[model samples]
Target: MTEFKELYVRKGSVAQDYIDIAQDIYVEINNYFKIIDCNLKFCRMMNKPRTELFGTSILDAIHEKDKIKFQNIIRNALLKKFKDGIIRSDLVDYKSRIIATTMKLNPILDDNNNIVGMFVKFSSFRLRVEDSAVNTIFMSIYNSLTDLYTIYGTDTKIRINHVNTSLLNILGYTRDEMMGRHVADFLVKNKDQEENIKKLFKSLESTGNFTGEVLYQAKNGEEIPIHLSISSLVHNGKVIGSLGIGRDMREQKRLESENKSFELKLQNQSKLAEFGMMLQGVAHNMSTPLTGIKSSAQLQHSRLIKFKDKLAEKYGEDREISDNITDIMKFFELIDQSVSKLSKIIKNMMSKSRDQQSLSKEALNLAYVMNQEIEFLYANQFFKNRVEKNISIQPDLPVIYGLYSDFSQSFVNIIKNGVDAMWDSPVKKMDIVMYYESGAIFVKIKDTGKGIPHDIADKIFDPFFTTKPKFKDAKGEEPNGTGLGLDSVRSLLKPYRAKITFESGPGKGTEFIIAIPVKENQTDLNN
Candidate 1:
């Protein structure tokens, strides 16, 4: 019979309907952190069979250093402030690899208000490591970049001064005793090596660097082998001093019976360059997949909207819930909105780092660009619940004839700096207002983040200067970043002939305003 066959078809289609609706939701698990449940997407992300994950504790897979943070997050879930709070952290897998993750924790309470469990809704983001990773990778990054350890000297007279605790412990010398002495005073001389040592010092003076094996007399009167490196410290175009890094070569000698001082420098530089390339690749990989995801969601939403229109036209009547057809149409519309929002976010993030193709000046809608930029800000994981925002643009704003990408880049950079400034603040909010006045377009951005200290206010715009801490991993080990972002902002605005200035009070907030002059003859309204 038709009725019996229809029932069978409905039952067969039930699982498909569930999958479609759950696509936007996250994978779930029980309170014990056992993998009692998961969606197909989460299973794919983990690349694990559901059966193998059934009895395993999620915490069991996390790195040891990060477990305490995870536990604190669990405890915070009990507090009302944090019950619905979003926690950003890294997740570890069976292979001991760290994966950056952002998730919201919703505590489930029972009839008596007893805490039962929690539901975690995971959000998608491209991860940026804040700490250094494991030993091998950390060592390569540590050596070639910045000097974390070893002895130091002044080139004026080679005075052994300003030694750090690390080198002090290694050399068995007190800082007070070494400060005034010439570096050569500590050298353990050989019968025939005095002339050779002088030649080596002279060679470095001319070349501005040295990397080689050397021997020095410890405070204990024992000769110690060292892998030494020294580079000129230039100031105002003069070599004011020399910075040196010396590693104890004993362990390396025991393994390879040779020094790798020069090789280490090369290796570090190579690793740093390779890592830079890897970051670019990661950006491409993340963006390409997200673009595809957005397209697919958009396609589905489009189809659903067409079907809803068909229903409206065929029925020719409006009734509340009307067999739930209207409800179904509304659901699809919501999905379309969400997917579109996510797509804008992804597009903004991807465009930020890519080399902006040169654009000739053209008329651009100022109001539209700001709204797009604000929506992109919401997509940022750091500002999800961390920062509040109020943005207002004057109605029917006059259009500006300029490089569109330039304004976009400049605005995004300011917004990003505002976000970074508030990282330590309790209340993080951004207020933005744009208006036309006095034949100029004015845009102001203000943040309730830690304001610029007077000392560094002068240097914030300097090339290669940044207050941003080095990007490290969960273990808190390595350093990363190029502090040229704001400098580029200044350069980006050159063609537009814009004037940018800011006001700051420590702990109060910082506000940056940009003003672009408009010609009186230029059109003020598109209409």
Candidate 2:
């Protein structure tokens, strides 16, 4: 057996060793936005030791007005939208003095090019201006305005005169390729955007500046969304050109899309929880009356049998009377069978709805639990009417232990997935088998529906990775394919130390096998 503690290793920080000697104030923040390390220059600038700065939120040092913008910058950087970006902001020093700084953000990526942290360099614009008038413009234009800077000649053609490195990188163009081209050649995204550009120029003519959202076309024809602010550049009290600075909106748009998706999934989950409560309540209310009906059925059954016997004795020679009595008894037997099934279903519902957060674990009969889930699924019209089910359970299986909801919920989710997978198939069938061996109970659920696609097999268990249609209505009661089913199964099985695996392929259908360890000390309820 491998010990849990042995599967780990420690690593040292290589960033500190390399960035410590750099002149600019450098800091590294993990993906969570916590400052993890900082160079000595950063420590001195804040007048705080590295100990006080490390592990703190970088947001603490950013001015309140720029916090949201800074956060979006970090999000976009982590998404690898660009190599590096520069933006201006006010930073709070250790003495709480506000310093205007131009900060550049660089994404630190792992071998797979996935961003793990952010590297930030801060240059105090105030200090940089103290050098000289010539160098101030040079540094501010090259360093401060590095995000998406463009200068257009304000001529009849509105020709581009200069483009910064950042703009070139974003547009995938060189200075030579972009210098003489009309600004509309890159800024026009569509006919609508072209009209918007006319409006922008109108605004600029009246106000000498325009700030709004627009689309910029890259060399490869990808439309890049950006928030742009443009101003008429003046030289000697005369307008010569227009300057444009833009912030990339790709990451912001992506985040909004993800947030919408999450909200839908959350709504679906909420509806499911509500439905569960309603079902549990109905089961609770019907349980007692259903049990009474079953009891009355049994008593009436015994009485009818006795009455038939008495009549047969009195009219032994009458074949008609005897035949009538036999028919009556058969009708009573059908009623009895139905009531018995209903009783079992109600019992299972009550058992499944037992408090899931109970303080103590209970020994659970795995076969019985599976049977209850199947019974509950049958309530679904598709499963009950269209699906053909085969079940085989080994006699006298050992008991597993857990809160009843954990096992019951996991089984239902897996079985429900099987049902949903087969919904569109010509042949809809399910096979379930359970047995015990080597102190573990195993249950297998197989379906004859369309199987999992090969490309997305690994992601099937990932939360919110559904191929289902987007949620459109809140009135729907079912899960609406939230993609949380399997991910939740993975979480629910942890308490039992259970393992679940599956075999699936397109058109061949899917089979899921779950192995749950049976602990000897967990048989209290079973006994």
Candidate 3:
């Protein structure tokens, strides 16, 4: 520690001076606006360790009503749009008390002048009451920035009660056109987002605010991405409407997409490489239908030959050949089903080969997705009859949020593994049961086959570890099943706040249990 004066400075003396400014709240946030560090004063204000505050989204610190103002400030600074790179806004500490302050975003730039991180300075602390405080501070700095924030007020029922000039301009709608309209009227609804929005309203009622990102539809039907923070409005000590502050995120999302393109390309390539094995399953499955079709076709042809002779002998020249149409039609049904199965198998495999980055992370009906894959497996008549399947998925199961292909592939791997394990066992049965209770969803998939060996059970999830005989790939080089099925299953469940646990023994079959927090309790996972 060292002493300092206005004229004299020491190496560590100015660091404490920086903390003293703005009541000692200095923070650094990442590209996603998540806190990376804070000054000791800020730590005292937050009442939590630096470790606890790390990675906390900065959105949690800004008052909902002023978030749009804050976004404009940081965004302009990072993009170098502002000449001075300074703006004022409000911050909420851990106690939810608002503090008015001036903020500056010092961009951590790379060689190309692109922002990599942000060094934020907070000063001029005060008690924030309205958005006008921030507007007044920036009014002089940004003369032509009248439409930077889009603001609207929605009633308890979500009907738009008011819209600011910026809101009208951003949405291309007149005040008269939007007033009294439901907020969702301008939203392009995704699967189960309605449920999420309802949850947001509940959050606003309880916590007085909510912050998240969502998509809004412009007047011309273009989908526009937006980050929104909303606070509940009160009248006569009761909730009346919500005040929403939003900033368009189209450019941000586009840049992020551009940056991730190469990484996603590599990931998709790896998945395609892994798919070479699934193609083998497709070929192995085709054999069941092909063999059945061959025998049925041969017997039907022999019957037709005998029928043709009898008809020719009775009539002049087999005039109305109705000697055996019933059996022939049966053979046609078998042929038709076989061809359909073959087509589905090929389509499923080809789809897995393509990049799925464009696939939206929507709420998927787990039962529906699982049933589709089950039908694909049933295409192989040999495997279908050999295993007993009992699926008891609830009728109104809550949707799980994630990519459908991922979870579908996950179940296919487990079921396929169980089928393979039953090759030499007398009792081959698979049971799928699901239920929800106390804000948690439980799934049990039990297989009554030669269970996993007790000695190797712990190693089952290891990649490239398998006990089965190798099946040759298209190139005639056999790979040891790439044993990543269970590993991949665990990865797929993570986004849903779920985990898989298994119980297995040498002769006692295996049961894999999956548990996911109900949607109401779905936090700590990516949206």
Estimate the TM-score of every prediction.
0.38, 0.53, 0.36
- For TM-score, the strongest prediction is 2
Local error of candidate 2 at residue 296 (angstroms): 2.4
TM-score of 2: 0.53
Instruction: Give me the candidate number with maximum lDDT.
Output: 2
Model 2 poorest ten-residue lDDT run? 1-10
lDDT of 3 by residue, 1-527 (tens): 01212212221466556654535366778777888777777777788887898998877778898888777767776676754644667778788888878776566655675776677767744433234567676644432343333334544546777666666677788879988787778777886567757776787668878787767887887787778788776778976667777778878876774456535535854685566566757666876877677667766767776776777778757434553554575666677677666666666655443322225566666676666667667766646887788988875767666676677767777777777676667888889887776766777788886889878888887555577655664233222355657767776677676878888887788888877787643332355
Residue pairs clashing, model 1: 130-472, 131-472, 131-473, 132-472, 132-473, 132-477, 132-478
Residue-level lDDT of model 2, residues 373-439, one tens digit each, is 7777877998899889889988578765666667777888888888888877899989989998887
* Candidate number that wins on lDDT, 2 or 3: 2
Candidate 2 has which clashing residue pairs, if any? none
* Backbone atom clashes (below 3 Å) for every candidate: 7, 0, 0
What are the candidates' C-alpha RMSDs?
43.8, 23.3, 28.9
Instruction: Write down the lDDT of every candidate, Cα atoms only.
Output: 0.65, 0.77, 0.68
Off by over 4 Å in 1: 1-358, 472-481, 520-527
Q: Higher-lDDT candidate among 1 and 3?
A: 3
